[model samples]
Target: MATGLLALLDDIAGIAKVAAASLDDAAGQAARAGGKAVGVVIDDTAVTPRYVTGFSPSREVPIVWKIALGSLRNKLHFLLPGALLLSLFAPWAITPLLMLGGAYLCFEGAEKVAEAIRPHHTEVQASAAPARDPQALEDEKVRSAVKTDFILSAEIMALTLATVAESPFATQVFVLAVVGIGITLFVYGIVALIVKADDAGLALAREPRPASTLLGLRAAPAGAPTGGDRALGPVTQAFGRALVRGMPVLLRGLGILGTAAMIWVGGGIIVHGLESYGLGAIGHTIEHAAEAAGAWLPVLSGAASWLVTAALSGVLGLALGAALIPLAHYVVTPVLRSLKA
Candidate 1:
């Protein structure tokens, strides 16, 4: 009986070890998958802040939290199951679906570029429109943001699913869940910080406690005037002022980066998908150009090659998106309108 019990315990230990290793492997895969979908993550983060615009300061974090929950629901409840179903039953469809999502990213990025070049009249009109009821407007904004988030979330999940397409079923599930949850938390957390940064800076500048207190410096001489009056207080206020001034610049930079990342990532996906479909001419040309560029600078060859490839891919994506814009404005819009009619 003792020997049998020892064997059972040994088996249990082996199983436990396997489970631990599997979890570690899943975590590693999750990181890589999240990295692959980072462009969408950036765009999502960049896009969400606008939804909270015009709302009172107090509502920003709560609005973001609600949208984050909606995003989470979209990913875990809808996209994850669909992705797993496709992976299990129609793996071949993944590439096409990814390409479609890539095209969408390209479209969105290009539209932004176009709007920057020439402002849309409707958008201007909307900006000037009269305000609605605060409660109703907030609800509308949240719903609209969540709806937009669904598209972006779907793309993120699809990219992640494609990344883990070859993993075991269990590992795929683990990776998808981790990437979904981790990315939702990360994007929304950064967004929350961004939207409230000015508030934080304002509070810091107005703080009654000595700035030294924040840094663990010597305690203020028994109730000394704080904020800009105390030693290092001016410095703290200056820093806070700088933060207030920098937030707008930071947001604009993020917008630019998000647009560029979308085009770059989308174009890369389309090019790779074409290559996989035996339509490798464009990809091959780009690859050769990149290789030539790489050969010119041996020390920085890898970086040069990657930059060349990305630039070429962006050019391709821009052309494709520009071509689609007219089609979207004309045929697609009219068709949908008529269908609704």
Candidate 2:
């Protein structure tokens, strides 16, 4: 009886060790999967802040939090399970679905670029609609943001799924869960900080002494001022001023980067999907060009190859998106409008 009990204990220990190793492997794979979806992640982060743009200062963080929660719900509740089911049953559909999502991204990115180059009369007219109450506006914004987040989250989750397609089903589930939670946290955390940064700067500019104290100054008596207090105020205010000036530019740059990233990622996905379908002419041409560039720049071969590929992808994405814009405006939009009617 003693020997049998010892053997049972040994088996339990072995199982525990295996479980621990499997968890570690899942974590490593999750990190890699998340890395592969970084482009979509950046686009997600960049696209989010605009939703909170017109809101009051007090509402900004709350709005961001609400949207973040929606994003969490999108990834954890919807996309994760849907992706798992698709992976299990309709594995072949994954690439085509991903390409569809990629096309949407390209369309969105190109629309933004077009708007930047020439203001859209339709958008201007739409903006002229009667304003709603603040609460209603806020609700509308949150809903819009959430809807947008759902699409981006789907793309991110799909990209993650593709990266881990070779893993066992159980492992894939574990890895995807890790990625979804981690990415939601990371993206929304940065967004929260970004939307509130101007307010934070304003607070610092208005009340530099307290800001200085937080920075490292020892607290002074309730009525008495410290010597360091006087010295830090100007410095803090100046820093705050810089931050205020810099934030708009930073946000604008992020918007541009996000748009470009969408196009680049979307184009790459479509091109790869074509290659998989044996329609590899465009991809082959790009690859040959990249190889030639790599040969020419021996020292920076890898970087040159990547740059060439990225440039071509961006061009293709832009072209495709431009083509789709007219189709969407004429056919898709009209159909959607009619359906709604």
Candidate 3:
């Protein structure tokens, strides 16, 4: 009995050690994968805040929550299995799929560039037109945001998986799981903080203590409510004021930057992918030119490389996106409209 019991204890100890090692490996792999996806993650963050636009203060958090839930579903239900299957059965397809996603990234980025250089004329719904219910509009935005999140999330997951392609299968699964959950939580949590900052400021401002209230008013002004006015304190009030005034501008900047990133990342991906497939002459030529240009200051070769790459990518993205506009306008939209009709 003593011998059997000792053997059992030994086996349990071994299992525990294995589990600990696995945990460490998972954490390391996850960190590495997440680092590789910094670009997609940034683009995701930049795109999400716009979804909360035009909603009442009370509704913003909930809408974000809904979209977050959808994002979770996208990762767990669809992306997780798809990634595993692709890794197993069709590893060869992975690069092409990534390139396809990269192309999409380029197209989107290019489209945004066009929109910026030439703002569209949105004909406002006629006053006589039936007004869209505020709730309905909010719901639509949430849905659209989730759909967008799905694409971005897929790209993120695929990129992460690609980064870890050489790892053990279990490690890949563990890394992806941690990255998906961690990113989702981090993103929504930050968004929640952003959306609620004004309200929190107001609550602090409206506190009953006179000095506290005065300080709050001064500190947070527009954000916090004020004394006797139901507005928060002066500090909070100012903060709230600043937040209200600044949020639109901030969102617009993010939009522009995100669009630029899409184009930048997209074009870069395509160029790199083409290089991978042995079609790198254009990229090589660009690099050579950049190198020669930087010869005047050999120390700045690295910065020159980055500038040349970015400029080449942006110019290509702009041109491709511009050319596609007429095609999209004449072909894609009509096909879609016809399909819907």
- Per-candidate TM vs. native? 0.90, 0.88, 0.76
lDDT of 1 at 64: 95
Cα lDDT tens digits for candidate 2, 1-341: 99999999999999999999998988998998898677788888888889998888899989999998998899999999999999999999889998998898889889999999999564467677897899989999999999988988999898888888878999989988999999999998999998888887877777757464866656654676666677877888877777888888988888888898889888988999999899999999999999999999999999999899988998999999999999999999999999999
What's the lDDT for all of these models?
0.89, 0.88, 0.76
Candidate 3 TM-score over all chains jointly: 0.76
lDDT of 3 by residue, 1-341 (tens): 99999999999999999999989988988988776566567677777877887788889899889988988999988998899989988887777877777667766777776666788887875787897999889889988988989999988888778778788888888888889988888878877776776666555445443344455543534554455445323544566567666655766776677676666666766676688799998778777877876775688877877777777876776676677668777998999999999
Worst 10 residues of 1 by lDDT: 220-229
User: How are the candidates ranked when ordered by lDDT, highest leading?
Assistant: 1, 2, 3
- Report model 2's TM-score to 2 decimal places: 0.88
Candidate 1, residue 115: the lDDT equals 95
Clashing pairs in model 1, backbone N/Cα/C closer than 3 A: none
For candidate 2, the 10 contiguous residues with the lowest summed lDDT are: 212-221
